[model samples]
Target chain A: MDEFSFIDSIKQKYYKQPTLLKGVGDDAAVFRQQNKDIVTSVDTMVENVHFAKYTMSPFHAGYRALAANISDLAAMGAVPAFYLVSIVIPADLSNEDAGSIFSGMESLASLYRMDLIGGDTVSGKELSISITVIGYTEPGRARYRSSARQGDLVFVTGSLGDSQAGFHILANKGEYEEESYFIERHRMPSPRVDFAAKLSGIKRVSLNDISDGLANEVNEIADASQVTIILNEKDLPVSPQYPQFPVDLQHKWKLYGGEDFELVGTVAEDDWESVKEAASNTDTVVTPIGYVAERSLSSKVYLITDNGKIPLYSEGYTHLK
Target chain B: MDEFSFIDSIKQKYYKQPTLLKGVGDDAAVFRQQNKDIVTSVDTMVENVHFAKYTMSPFHAGYRALAANISDLAAMGAVPAFYLVSIVIPADLSNEDAGSIFSGMESLASLYRMDLIGGDTVSGKELSISITVIGYTEPGRARYRSSARQGDLVFVTGSLGDSQAGFHILANKGEYEEESYFIERHRMPSPRVDFAAKLSGIKRVSLNDISDGLANEVNEIADASQVTIILNEKDLPVSPQYPQFPVDLQHKWKLYGGEDFELVGTVAEDDWESVKEAASNTDTVVTPIGYVAERSLSSKVYLITDNGKIPLYSEGYTHLK
Candidate 1:
């Protein structure tokens, strides 16, 4: 197809707005922001690394790519503004597959009012999609990974290990043919943008999403804030069938399995009750998992089990591994 | 490497900045724009299609990926602000190779004062790099492809066809070993950012980067503007060794070959002289190639030859093709 024709079709499908002064077919898209600071994040998903190549659907791949990046913004407590997408597909893939991916992404983007501004499309040896999401927040309202104080209580939105369970079901054969919850959780994740936005002035300390598992993310916050994180293993919000997996193995997996795109954050102990009430009103779950303490990087993450306190292992998905 | 550690190293190397209110290890990087509108563009380079699978050096791949996207901002006449990069590499490639790519991109980015913000990395079947660059421009200073008018004079900065020639020689056996002019052009063609910035207030008719060659870009301007584009074949610029190709295809290739990241723009003929002079003073060559005119739906591009005007053919790289 001619470049102009391709771009024109995309613009018609995606760039509909009074805010978009320019969109596809231009060298760059221009946007007017009411706020001064702009938040941006870029996330790339590959065929085998981020997802299993053969088992994944194109639509799910598209949704997951945007969802993962949008979750990052939620971690920052920033509102989604615009996004740029880059897709590299194998030459063997059908045009229908490519279109479905865009359709899925466009569906989410339109729902969020995230403008699909500009990006590159090319042929590659594997299917890969990278999205750069640009967002905004009140200049000082944005949260970071360095603000948690010694007495802050740590919290996480929604249940953990659902994504891991979802992945297990989706990656395996017959056991979950009718498991829509598992498939949907694996495919589409809510970024918790509204919840994060509500927590704006309530003092969110050391915020981030659970992409690299809950324990790994806690370790990240601990390392960044130079503080120790003490967790109550019994308090972990697990699903009803959590005991089906081996006891020790499941706990380890729950804390280390990546792709749990929930927001893990912290707040002052005093504000915890009010924050929980506000979150409940918004229909967003906020569970207190742990507390932040003085910096002790040597063994920062600890899990309180019935046996005794144990160091949380850092066995999360490593890129090289 | 663990995701956090990889991201931490990337942040230390590229995202060290005071203006960056927040950066990588966080959910998103927040930047203070000082009340400037953000101009954004994204470009991706895939292994086999964009660059030869094993021919282009990793450093060159990195350089080209960043340079190509940077050229888009230059086409829009916007100044560099910040960038986020997403890379997908094969599992077999060592971290050193990835480091080399980032180092090379960093070299170019430093010259432009582009803060490397945040990104995601994953292992793919082949190498791919996607960069999203955001620039700061005056509210309405951006030039677009739909604003060209009848009687508007077409202008291009720097010479064309050199990159095409460079690709031709580099693809042939034993030709890439020497330091040829075409090879240099292919490896590194400077984006005309300074010249583009100067043309911000001159009432630009239309603007676009000449990637996929000048013919494709001029057609884009014409189609977007709903006008005919007439080009003088003799007036086309040529490199010093013009007749070395197999046939007298210098002008033909310049009109149709891809990978020339020069800016092709249109402005009122009245201001063309002054614009040309100003561009020349900066050692930036600004040459007139054609004029805009009314066109029928079917035939919009006409090549002005000694024999008379004839229908122009589409010859650049088509993504769908």
Candidate 2:
């Protein structure tokens, strides 16, 4: 199908939201959000750079791209409402694969009842998907990276390093018994929207989605909040199958390998119980792996390991160096 | 500089808006829009496909990309407010060139007092920009392509095909005395946002931006509105230097050449005067190009020329065929 027909098909397939006045077949999509602050994030994933066509299916790529953007909204303590996807299609891509990409995104968006408002489709040399998601939060209630306080507990949702391990298995075509579990983690990451939405009731929490691994993300919180973060290495959450990997690779993946799509944040000592209650309500696992400390000279993140207290540098997936 | 440093530089350079609760350095940008309906459009310009580095400067490409998206909002009769830019940078691109792309977008954005809210920057094999612009209009007041009525007069803002002619001059390295004017039109096409913002006062209108040439835009309006559009070829506005070009080339450019970034729509004959007044108020040029007729069998667009009336086909740019 041509671009217009494909768009028409998408318009026909996706259900509309009550607030969406206009969806497809318009110069712009129009939506109303009453008395709520809008949270928006844009993310682009390119072929080869983000995913290989052989290793990552179009469906997974689409799911992961949209999931990553939604994770951003979740980090801001917002509920995703709408999204626009701009996709650059390579000539070699099949129509089924192209449709699968949208199917993947729709599968995730459906869980949140998010509408696909509008986007652009173009033919290019490589397949790339740039998604812009719009979500809503109460006025002045959205969480921020700069809100972390000294003595606050730094916590994480779900297991860290599972996605990276999954990716490693997929890339190497590993035939381990746990290969399916790892691969699924890599292919279908669950954005912590439910857990984050519950955090809106807790005041003054700092949050950041772990797109760039734990070391990089906590360091960002520390840098933004002008505080020092101390993480207990043993407390880092890992899956049951994580021990199957080499010890060194496990350490590396847990620390540096990115694309976890889990929330890492800090909450007050008094509010820790509330956070745990929120996690329980959402049926999500929450782990306190670290604690915020007063900055000595400058903001820094440190890992408390058996070796020693070593500064955690942002060695994860630095783009455009 | 690395991606983080580059983003830091951008965050430092761009000014913030009062409505913007949060800008860069977060997972998502948060902004408040009180009671206004949000109008959003996303457009992606791929290098070597939409533009060539040799023919289009980075600054112009950036400016044009944002301008195109803003034009969509304008077509919906919304006031341009904020934008997010996602840029894919090739390894070969210089930092200065990379910065120029944003500079281009900022130049036009400053005119509308639009804020550079948030976006993504990634390294890729080709330089591409995907921009999502968010604008606001009064609730249920945004214009649509399907709003045209029978006996309405079709109107367009500014001259048509100038950008195409300018692009031709630039691509062919033609150094005519008017080359600079045409080149400027091609590189920095004005998005008629001022005139469109004034259009909100009009009661009912069908609007479409002439990005994919007038023929395609009018046909879109016709198809959406279920009306037949009859255009008078003689009434189609042209630049002062337009006649100097070959007649056939001018006709081809005016009809099929895209990237004009002008507004085209149909308004009631009674409302035509109000549109003209709105144009005059904004100091914009407006022309009566055609009239909307009742759809007999199916929606159609026709042109009245010296020879006879001819059916207009959507021969504009069609991506991902």
Candidate 3:
């Protein structure tokens, strides 16, 4: 269980790249990406901070860290190229166990053509993983968060909060194999790269990955654009099992529970049909969740309910808090 | 003590850049580097791992995390451009203390021209800081560790083991105010950016930042290049305080103790004098430490001492052993 062996196992299990000039054994991972703008971002997952170690699988832990960072690149309409992972694992953990974590990360990186460039592995009291993803966007075509306007229609790429439901089911150890869909959603949420890449200029208003629940992320776009967000409760996409919950629970899960890796974005009114058509070709549905309004520079976000427009508190999983 | 407050404090204290498209608050920091070869590296500092939390000041902790990453860029002959810091702090710490950590990082970034880009802050059981630095090198001039040849003379910038001595003094609370030079060397080692920039076209044998002790790093370069390195112990540079150490302790600390952020490199034997002269103008002295030797392909590093040639073992710090 030495550092070199742990790193070797990771390299054998995960690092498969033709572009890497040098991989895990070197001081740095060297890569070359041509004809596109390189987009880079980093995300750190810590034990008892981002996740509880005993409650989550090491594979899922590894996958989630990479997925979260890839999602940031996806939000920018970039193709993930490579990643550097700095891991601080507990000293007691054997190299075999560490290899499991790295195996999971390497698998994801291989799947996405992400060359494992360089990372530092150190001993710590708990597990902490910091992954920095480097991606590329076509010249002058990267979508940004400042592009949303007053009249754009908001849309979400996939169903929300299934990951949260998965968390609850796994935590309770509820005996329901029928809940596999939600369980997998929570454990291994996909970063919407393919869906986002094709979503170039038309629906390329303000965009963010739905991580801190739709309610909070939607508000983030609204707050950033300095506009009012009107969320249509009926249009909010939910998993098939969502209705099985009581009304209050469903609302609570949909609004506050986090870890949904869907894409929440906005599109212009006239371009909505084409955006939907393009998304349809990818076998993914884009549901209209809301519309933008003139600046609602207030502390409140709201849901348009049948009863009336009611205040929707923007409270999701606050990692910092 | 809230997350927003913590972020606000960092924004006010550290994130000041006129060209920063988005700084601390956004999902990612955006900026444009001149279309030069973009050089990037990442380094992490962990509590009770990289530094003992009880012993290391939060400000030095913060400064060192950034400095280590910046040093990587310096080794690559790149200019400091931008950095993203991901900090995982224990919830028990206050917001103002968090501000001070960032304030320390800001002072270094401002001095080095590294803009504080976007970062993620989270509550964890222990403190951890990961910094990713992005810099630019003129096209095709970025130095690497694989470029050394058989006839190259190994060179080191500045004296080694000063940081280790500083560590000893600091640990014992030794009165070393008269030895301020060594203390500063340990507290803050300068990255040789200006000197490295001028060393272009000199065809360096290999280049690396010396943090994990000279012997260990020289072994790394030799291991990577499949060459034997021969070092003369008598020729090694020692700071003025070297005589204060008992002989064995001096050699042990100089050879194995880590955290000296200097450059260990190799150059053509013919270019040795010019390289030394160039380093002199930068107010840093470069000394020849060793020579690349032709050895059995399987031979490890060797050192020539008064006793005889002995295998050089890497007894430095390992992250997850």
Best by DockQ: 2
Screening candidate 2 with a backbone cut-off below 3 angstroms (N, C-alpha, C), the clashing residue pairs are none
Model 3 TM-score on a 0 to 1 scale: 0.93
Tens digits of per-residue lDDT, candidate 3, B1-321, equal: 666666666664454444344455545555444446667777788776676655457777777778788778777777777888788888777776677678768778888677776677876778888888877666666677766678789888888888878767766765664466776666676777777777765755478887788888888788767788888898888887677877887887778767777888888889887787779778888889889887446646789999999989766565311
Instruction: Write candidate 1's Cα lDDT for B1-321 as tens digits.
Output: 644456566665545445677655677888876655668989888766777644567777787778888899988888887888888867777777788788778778888877887787776678788898888677777888888888888878777788877777777755333346788678776777878877766765478998778878888787778888888877877766756775556765688877778888888889887778669766888889888887445437788988999877666575212
| TM-score (0 to 1) for chain B of model 3 | 0.91
Tens digit of per-residue lDDT, candidate 1, span A176-219: 43366766777887788888877766755568898888887888
Compare the candidates by lDDT and give the number of the best one. 2
Clashing pairs in 1: none
TM-score for chain A of every candidate model? Answer: 0.92, 0.96, 0.91
B1-321, model 2: which lDDT tens digit per residue? 988788877663555566778777789988998878999989999988888877788899888889899989999999898899899898999999999999999899988888888889988888889999999987777999999889999999999899988877776764566888999988898888878878777789889998898999998898888889899999999999898788899998888778889899999998888999999998999999889888654999999999999999888564212
List model 2 lDDT by residue over A62-149, tens digit each: 9999999999999999999999999988899988899999999999999999999899988888888999999999878899999998
| Model 1 CA lDDT for position B237 | 76
TM-score of each predicted structure versus truth: 0.93, 0.97, 0.93
| Every candidate's lDDT | 0.77, 0.88, 0.74
Flag regions of model 1 displaced more than 4 Å: A1-10, A14-18, A53-55, A173-178, A297-299, A318-321, B1-19, B53-55, B173-179, B295-299, B318-321
Clashing pairs in 3: A122-B319, A123-B319, B147-B205, B148-B205
